[model samples]
Target chain A: MKSRLRVLRAERGWSQADLAERIGVSRQAVNALETDKHDPSLGLAFRIAAVFDRAVEEIFDNPHRTEGPG
Target chain B: MNPFTTGPASREYQLATAGWFTLYGVILFTVAWAVDGRGLAAPWVYPAAVAPALPIAGFLWTVLRFMDRSDEYVRAVLGKTYVIAVHLTLLLCVAWGFLEVYAGFRHLALFWVFPVFWVAVAVTGRFIRTTR
Candidate 1:
């Protein structure tokens, strides 16, 4: 899944290591997440959201979601 | 500290693995000495031969504990590596067994399986790309 984690971290002026430390994950994990090589589990997603101070959707793109008719 | 491992759990796992291997080496040497140099009896040698397995069990326990303490991503990566390693080891063992039976190849010791599995793990881990 694609994520705006890199952009969000950049906006916050946080290096990958800084963000990884804040989220209690390794820098390599953070790199993998940002590169879309790894997807976060539900619990990890929530933790990432909490660390970013945003909803999970704001950081990770949900490819499964479809637009409903108005 | 293993390059693939990170965080506090990594340190713990490394220490545990070292301890287990150290114990394994000592037990193995002792058993060999008893069986060979000291001429241990048949009945006693059977139980003595199994002594090194205790440290192997400890190593396996350490692996399980490390998995429990690892984060989701590391666990996932390791899970994949193990799966691949298991399959590879099994395939090789089966093929070698056929060769031994049909082609009159020399019989391989069962203890070699553990080392073969570890070799497979090392090979697969290189390609699997775990977090450093």
Candidate 2:
């Protein structure tokens, strides 16, 4: 799943490691999310959204979306 | 804190596992020493052989506890690694069994199973990281 994690993290001026620590995961995991190499679970998506103060949908684009708003 | 392999909880997990394995090795060697030159017909032989399983069970429990305490992503990484290791170990062991039976290869000791699995995990993990 593609994500705007790097953009949001950049807006916050937080490095990958800083964002990772806030979300309680390794920087590699955060990198995986940012690079679309790994899809976050629902819980992790929520945690990421919580860290960024945004909705989960705002951070992760649902790869399955067909009729929904992009 | 490096959650993958090093943290307070991770340290606890390693130390506990190490301690249990030490006990397991000690029990196995002591039993072997006691039974040396003695026939397996003795009543105590079977029980002595089975005694090492106690520490092994403890070791497994310690692993479960480590998984229980790890963060979600770390647990996921470990879970996938273990699954890969399990399948790889089974595949290789089965292939080796066929060769041992049909091609006259030497049989491996049963005690090498866990070590073989760990080796597979390390190889698979490295492959994943390097490919990434």
TM-score of each: 0.90, 0.82
lDDT of 2 by residue, A1-58 (tens): 7789999999989998899889987776777778765678889899999988988988
Tens digit per residue, CA lDDT, model 1, B1-132: 232566788789889977987887899899999999999998999999999888878877888888887767777777888899999999999999999999999999887887798789889877886433
Docking class of 1: acceptable
Report clash pairs, candidate 1. Answer: none
lDDT of 1 by residue, A1-70 (tens): 8889999999999998899889888777888888787888898899999988989887888887776222
Candidate 1 chain B, which ten residues in sequence have the lowest lDDT sum? Answer: B1-10
Best by TM-score: 1
Summarize candidate 2's per-residue lDDT along B18-76 as a digit string, tens digits: 79979988998888887885555468888988897788689778878987976665566
Look at candidate 1 and tell me the lDDT of residue B101.
97
Q: Model 1 segments beyond 4 Å from truth? A: A68-70, B1-3, B130-132
Please state the interface RMSD for every predicted structure, separated by commas: 4.9, 5.0
